[model samples]
Target: MTTVDPTYAACPVPLPESERVLLGHGAGGQLSADLVTGLLLPALGSAAPAGPLEDAAVVPVGGVDVVISTDAYVVSPLFFPGGDIGCLAVHGTVNDLAMRAATPVALALAYVVEEGFPLADLRRVAASAGRAAAAAGVAVVCGDTKVVGRGAADGLYVVSTGIGHRPPGAAPSAGAVVSGDVVLLSGPIGSHGTAILSVREGLGFDADIASDTRPLHRLVAAMTAAGGTGVHALRDPTRGGLASALNEIAAASGVPVEIDEAALPVPPAVAAACEILGLDPAHVANEGCLVAFVAPERADEVLTAMRGLPEGGGAVRIGTVADHGEPGRVTVRTAVGSRRVLDMLVGEQLPRIC
Candidate 1:
């Protein structure tokens, strides 16, 4: 019997030339995308996953659809203006479940602490997380904590898992996203990334900007009630911003998406900061915004429902799923009347931006 290398035996496409993982690999950009499509999928032998991998994995047992999702938070400077890592972890998990139109019921939390970390800080983080979960009406049923060497871990990092029940008559999935569906965006973009950067860089813009970190489960319920099954897919533009989220949905749904630049709802502070820092607002990270793919007929209703919510006041219809099939691509129509391919960032523009 001969033993063969897994790369050569099972890989469908050639692996990347690089051997080491960089910060960009974790940026949720093109490199991250390649890692999934090129390496992980082949290694798992799950080229054909049950569905296009979205925010959460939906499992059906005993005729009940269960939504499960996990997320990790390592944003530098654990505390920011609008949120800290604690609230971020809870919000992230809750949003993931909500992406699939699921109602969050419970959460599990795990924390990694560096040596010499203050107990008071730990207590504060825990308290914040508890408050967030409580506000979302989700219980933190179980939790764990671990300590590592000073150099082994950052000050602190949080990992959270959420469980939710899929709503009846709601079948939201990336695969369900079809061409001609209206693309909607919830609130302004790039605030979270800009806020983090401003604090770290000592750059103060006119209006105080903060992370838009919050749970969207309630807003999701409003959409379901208004749009019913018209809501096709939902994506939280987190690590790689709105551009990456749209691209992911396009690739997963096997269709092209077109975005309108003039319609983007970028807050003034965020836009000015991005311009000064030479950052593309589209590629910046956002914690509390989401991209919605909805049927054209119900698009207005869903948009109205979102606008009525406090967390979704800035919701706007931004683009449309292209009718022509040019899958795995996104195009943006500029205010100047030109179109450009909205390619995923080859490397991270901002590392650990989430």
Candidate 2:
């Protein structure tokens, strides 16, 4: 007779009926969400906190709130069209802090390297990290390095942590989102995800396509300065793309979101690449773009402020909050007079994408 564990019976987010983890666990899709809500949070206990973890955690530091965030980078191709894993690590952590109107003050990093890795490559990656932190005006206050036996690890992997201070009177939270708010997308989508895929799969779209991986703290600052408290929520559509970002906001705020497909600002090259791969550009990841929920009255001013910045030059109002619809629902108004429910990715579309 075979014995089965009864623990699986009470799982909230359905797993794949497997006893071990899958690649989907790290895809930042449905499986990732399930892992948190089902296992991690429960282990943390009922008094831990409400809801799953957001990009960054805001902790009260006596006089003010300090935001801290961290992320790891293991992209196969260390060097990509627009960035390397080192810079990606920096920008990712910095952007997480910026999303909550936090200004980064310092960063810490750790590197796990494979034995026999070239010293030249390590030096190059380290130099890039330093330059990125300096350019972002944040100091790298601490670091650690370790090496593993050959084949035990990838060429290199980076883990980074960021510390920042929330701007006074600036509160960008998912719970702050409300009906009658405006939705703004900072720029074109799918550039970063597609750029990496093009390199990994040897896709021929290299002549012009590249990842839009750059620091977004400055852009967030500009929007906050213009809209002040009018800006309710801010998120950078990264790992799970635009669809996941909007769905998260809707659920967190208990509001309905409607975006126009025709209004989506996808670059021509990115759209072509996505169509060829049977991927929706909106579902593809981005490293530099952001989604903002703002008061309707200040939407125009915020849009203008974003447009004035180089990174947000392609900013546009893609949708609005709705009064009636399924709560926590996201719908896309198709160009041909139809509506499509935009659901969170149930399975991995692109693996190791971010």
Per-model TM-score versus the true fold:
0.93, 0.94
lDDT per residue as tens, model 1, 170-234: 77777688878999999999999999988877788524799999999999899989999999998
* TM-score between candidate 1 and the true structure: 0.93
lDDT score of residue 49 within candidate 1 = 51
Off by over 4 Å in 1: 1-18, 46-49
lDDT of 1: 0.84
Model 2 C-alpha lDDT per residue in residues 84-190, reported as the tens digit of each score:
88888899899999988999999999999999999999999999999999999999999999999998767999989999999687788876889999999999999
Candidate models: Cα lDDT each: 0.84, 0.83
